[model samples]
Target: MKQANSGALVVFGLVLIAGLGGALLARGALYLGMHEGDTLHLLDMALRMGLHGQWPHLDFMTPIGILAIAPIAGLVAMGLGIGTAILWAQVLVALVLLLPLVRMAGSRFGGLWSYVMLGYGVVLCLALVHGLANPAPSVSMHYNRWAWAIVYVVLPLALLPDRGRARPYLDGALIGLGVGALVLIKVTYAAALGPGILVALLVRREWRVLVVAVVAGCAVLAVMTALGGSGFWVAYLTDLLTVAQSETRPAPGGIDFADAVAGPANMPSSILALAVVVLLRMTGRKAEGLALLVLAPGLFYVTWQNFGNDPQWLLLLGAAVFALLRTDQPDSRHAGRLHDAMKIAGVAALALTASSAVNIAYSPIRHLFAEAGNTVPLLSALAGQDDIRVAEKRLYKVDAGVPLDGVGQPFAAYHDRADRKELSRLKGEVLPACELSTGYNAMFETIAADLEAQGHAGSAVLTADLLGSLWMFGDLKPLKGGAPWYYGGAPGLAAADLVVVPLCPTTEKSRATILAALEKSGWRFDELRRTDVYILLRPVRP
Candidate 1:
């Protein structure tokens, strides 16, 4: 027991040091204005909640979606601040999850279990960092990210042994609830964990747990339905069902689809493959764990693909691997030699785990190295304490308006009292309609055209990132500070007397044809702007 406590201490210490180090590094970058994706969105949601007393979707004033990054937001609200809280939240969730797995491994294999947890932690943190960089808005924003993090912790606890059987039912119920929370958080990994969840259920064969999970899941869904409205729930359910109908979808433009297999998923998928081995070699209930371990990833991979092999998904994946590799039979005479082999394997696993740690740790190290890149201007931008005149230039693009395209909200920072205050006061759910009336920028012309074709011309258009396509192509009149479409200020499409739309003809012939079309429409064809993107306008009063 003393030794076990010692081992736990060592692991705990390492985790703390590593987590703090990682947080400090990230905080520095954040402080220096090195903002990543979802950073803005998450902060926006928090500011809306904090400054405005809103609860994610309940705060309809801000045309943003739900505060899916709730855990982070809650931490931030509690005064832990933003970036540090987010990083620590990820680490803490990972540690809570590792507890059960370590216990299970120790129950069967002893000290080696710690090593396995350690290794898995490394892999998960590494993968999480990758996702952290350009966190998909839903995935990283508010409660959504936290919910996924909880899923990472909860699912592993469920699969681990119920040590003393105290609350196998509770554990199972918690797993279900966590999973249910995840499903509601965002449909991001709903598809990826199918095989994994199945494997866990089949392995545990605890129907009560499943019932608890179902009930918990239903309760969460019911609450969301009640709060978000039946129509919203219907749409949410429909979107989930639609995505599930297809096993794999095309990767977004820049994201790499291939990374799905190389990361932590390898662990779960490997276990599934090993389950075949276990079923063939082991006997009775003893073999059930291994078999289920193997089965889960296989089933999950087929059912949900978005997990895209993210490292965090490996929480159970690592446990399954350890389960499969564990030998149930006693060693007898070769026990000493076998112990040595186990020790060696444990060490090797720790080393492998260190690789994961390094992967996660690498971000901070890189950021440290990039520290030199922080100039007076960047630091000023980050501190939110820059010289007003210089800071104004960096924060508000003279050319780009308050809300840039693709970056859905207006005001680079939600601190833009004039805009965000009104946005946060909204009474109910708000979905920013992406339509042509927002204005024509090079970045969203295709999207704008689609909206127009769908008869949504007068709807507001917002993009996640203004690709600077609008400025190069369109004759869009400047709105307030920057280009028209970029600011958070809602272009009162209802009130606009005139609006411009641009189309870029790549080839000379195509350009002539487009010009001809414009001429035929009886609208004047004027080459008012020149760039890679083209802009056209229509008089609203006409």
Candidate 2:
């Protein structure tokens, strides 16, 4: 018992060091400005709940689950400023994910190989940092990254050597918890893993495990619905069924079997899966090998559907390699051949993993190293600020008090506000800056001033862009039913007395549709203000 406890402590310490080191590296490489669409939306909802006692209504059109938002809410409730809370939460989650990988590696491969496995896991995670640290408004955002990590963690437990001897109930409960958590994050993504998990359990004849997983998954759904309110189910189901069917949302294209197997993102996983098959065959574990073969296609489909080029999917490959190599079987007549084959396969997978990490993280890593000297002062100056600002022609600042900047403003603003604090301190801040093509800050300032001039202060206002930023920055009331883009423009626009539009080509079609709707409803709109990039409109006497 004492020896086992000591071994566990040593493994924990090694994992802790590796996880923290990798997290720090990721922070340096990939951490920068917060993403507007998803990250900001989560932060906005959490802030609203914490600061003003408001719960996000189900009427809003978004795929983000309650679990995703809950962490930020809890952090903010603890009196941590939103910016600090978000950064710390992201770092902590990354570290927690490393724990299981470390344990599995230590148990299976003692000595330096345990640390090698840890390095492999970190590299896999580094590939994902691009999306997690600096997300975009695409369908696969941070939640998708979380789903990928969860799948990596859960899938390997089946291949662990001690599975047969483990407590049936404990093992079942753990599997159930993993699957349930994934479901709570995103059901569609979970769908990809659910079938494979069910099949694996069936192949193993682990009926207890299957039953526990189903019951736990259902309980999770029920609890989530209850916490999010009765309307949560209605809104969640409606959005899932409707928005997913909408033509405007980009859908994954079909891939030929060859491309699916050979795509950059899919290649490593394919190779690793093949390696697992060979390893299992040599060890005479036919049942496990067959179960893995069944799982390979589903996992590939999930990766292909999300983003085929992202190296993050390679983590699945790493998980497969770790699982197959870690078994505790004694040496056999085939052991020499098996060890040689495993080494070659493992080395190839690691090389690919490293290449992918470099491909995805190169820019951020370069930027971080290039500006390392200025990081401390920059962070000190901007700490606790979340409002977006531009400085030194090299960075776009967020008011969250973090002195981080990115390459450019990817979205437009609905109104221009001029009361921004122009500081000399920002003039020399060295960071990666985001160039704004259109004068969004100026446009937003003008809109805010114009709205106040028109006696529209405190009134619910609708916007086609920057809905959360506008409300939070201008101290305006939340638009009833949430942002039009999320809730469908017609309903949110109908509930507001004023609507702000940014007339970019990307928005032209949606703008035209909204205008036609207003005309059909016998509502006349007067243009309140116009800029090169934005136009503010108000309902006028019909």
Candidate 3:
């Protein structure tokens, strides 16, 4: 017994180190590569709330959860730069979410195979971290991966037959917490998993466990709702309905079973294979059968929601491999064949993951670390100096030499080295503006200057192409309550003194609508400036 305890401790330490180390390494790599995208905007909004006590409106269209952004906000409030704050927050989250799984795996497998299971967990963490930094079609920083990881961790424990007397309570609490967190992060995802978990509990007839889980989950929801206020509920429900009704938004669709079973990553095929293994095990192993049965509904939900890009499928693959590898009766012919098939599927999944990683070689871990040795010092030097005007002037001078792309350009491509002079320039002048500009520094500055010259700097400016840039660069507030898209059919058009619409192929319809509205309102329109990208417009005198 003493030896078993010691072995568990050793494995725990190793797994903790690997998981935490991998997370931090991934964070550092992403930071060095200057990889910022969708999530950063969410973080920015959270930071504003935390730092300035400015909460987003209840009707705000974006659907990010408050809990996911809160930690980043907390980190930033503690005087960490945004990059450093995000790094630490992500690492902490990864550890919190993964450590329980390691403990459970070690407790169940209890040997070298236990170590392999923990290693598998570490790889998944690394894969998620990689996705966060360099998002691809198959892997990205989305809620689904995290939700599925929790599912993978909880389902095994839920299915284990010999969890002892106290384990049901503990497992129930853990599931409650995990699912609660997922619920706060994404309610729709929570809705998907909830039915499966409830049905599983009912099948097992674990009334006490079900009660504990339900109570704990409700408590979490109540607390979060209290903190977020009543407005948050309104916002959440509104967003949910809006997303469901909107044709532009991606909605969950029915899964093609044949396609899933023959998918390239072997995820779907492995799941089907695992189902067969579970049935075979039922002949002699009731515990394994029950476990698979409990896990089946959630797994099916994940497979159905698999839109070919989500990394959640990998979690399913990992779970199947773990089950196959750990199943006893290795000498049985059926078991041996099942094990072999699982091995092949596991190898295929690993290969596909490796291929995806290689395809994003631009943000390789080694390169990021090596480059960080140069960039970190510069980042340090620029810290603690927050002067917006100096940064704006520098941004105005630093041109990209080409017109701005709607999607921001990569910062690394623009500034390769953090030489002392370059660092000083960034620190004393441009860094503040660069942070806000998001690769649109030069263009935003030009537009802002033109707006100022035309006496419309502080006006509620309506922009077609430059959405956030109007406020971020030109000190112009958006004319409408929501995003620019809302302004297309918005009631008050004549209220806006200046309207800047890019006369491009993409904006032709919107531009025509604005023109028609202007003509209808008896407000004469004159072109203020015509650039290759935008046609700035202003109202003529009545």
Candidate 4:
């Protein structure tokens, strides 16, 4: 009892320090702007879903995040400005949802291992880091990330070493529902730690409990499908398949072996630690112990799936510790050593988390400093050149590993180190193109096109990209101002008297197709100077 109490105190201290440090760093430096790519597009869809009282799903090709995720993010944005509120909200939510899992584990394991599991697990670690720095931290994208932690990671720990008096089936079902909810939010999450949960449940011989969970999940899904239409099923399947492809498919930025090995190594030492527990379980050690051996693999698989060292990985550690803590056998002499080992691990995990928090907090500033330091010296040396523009031109021409070149040009590309290399490769390549007249795009373009089709052509025509600068265009504003759905399709092409596209090959294909369609409809293309983006024109109808 004395050792357990001591372990609890140490564990609490470490988690507190890690959590507090992460929260403070995230609050200070990270800005909340959505870029033009994945995060922006996902949030844009979420906003529309919230406004219209429609839940987004991946039907046909429309991208819709999970149900709980989108609304939570949309509500947060509504209450606080979208950019500033999102990052904080994500961290708070991850903590709120995860702390319970840790406490539950502590209740079962003794405080020592529960703390280590919660603190050092890959899911929790990754999420804490990701929450602090990632540009978009809306629950929409990261919701499943957390769900995986709770369902596969934490819930399994909770189930093992059951006290016999507790509500096992109900608890398991609720945990399953949480996982199901994650699947609904982002189809990508359907695979995230799901198989692991199944494996754990089976090993525990909780087959009846599993049945209850499945039934409850099926019932909820049925209700949703009935209310939402066939589009719901179609979208769900589409999202699931797409997510599977993305995970399994090789991309330039796919798997990194070093990240895999280094991430989970600190917490657990050997298969022996796990092996002893399993042997004891089968050798009448503890029922919970035997169940845990199966559960551990699921947790590892989930953590391994997220190769980028995201903060969500911490939850996996939390789950593992929870499992360990629950296995405390009072008669075993090794309990004292286990308690001491866990305390040391907890302390070390806390220190690592603190360092991680600092690294994430200063990442942007570090990048900015590195870029500025190099540029300042060269500018000073070139200060005396007669043609300042010439010096500037020369400086701009230097390949900065970005698509945008030339000094003083509008819409100059900001090179993001994270995606620049891959994005540059994708620049000229034709993608698996999204046609303008389908899914959400269809809905958006239809509304915009209706305005033009009904002789509202004189209204200011604009695309989603120009939404922020709506005031700059003309007196005419979007029927649904700043709604991104209408930004890319036939509506975006036809609503405006002028069109401008980037000069990249992808843009060229889109621009060419759009222009050809417009000319076929008797509209004339008045070519405007096109750079990386686009510019096109048509005569006023008399």
Which candidate tops TM-score?
A: 2
lDDT of 1 by residue, 444-512 (tens): 434345445545444332121222122111222212111111222222233322333323221122223
How far in Å is the alpha carbon of 72 misplaced in model 2?
Answer: 0.9
Candidate 2 residue lDDT tens string, 91-210: 455566566554444543444545544544443333324432232112125456556656655665544444234444545555666677776666665777676677777877877767
lDDT string, candidate 4, 201-270, tens digits: 7666777667877776677677777877778787557544544443222221244434443445423422
Expressed as tens digits, the lDDT of each residue in 153-258 for candidate 3 is 6655555433223466766777787778877666655776676567656666777777888777888888977887877778667666655554333333333544
Task: Assess the local accuracy of residue 461 in candidate 4 as a C-alpha lDDT between 0 and 100.
Answer: 50
Give the higher-TM-score candidate: 1 or 3: 3
Model 3 score (lDDT): 0.49
Clashes of each: 44, 24, 0, 46
The order of the candidates by lDDT, greatest first, is 2, 3, 4, 1
lDDT of each: 0.40, 0.52, 0.49, 0.41
- Cα lDDT, model 3, residue 89: 57
Off by over 4 Å in 2: 1-39, 52-59, 91-128, 131-140, 163-165, 252-283, 305-313, 325-339, 355-446, 465-468, 483-491, 505-526, 539-542
Q: 450 in model 4: Cα distance from truth in Å? A: 22
TM-score-best of 1 and 2: 2
Write down the TM-score of every candidate.
0.53, 0.70, 0.66, 0.54
Which ranges of candidate 1 are over 4 A from the true structure? 1-22, 25-67, 72-112, 115-128, 131-152, 163-165, 188-199, 238-249, 252-357, 361-372, 375-542
Q: Pick the candidate with the highest lDDT.
A: 2
Worst 10-residue stretch by lDDT in candidate 1?
Answer: 477-486
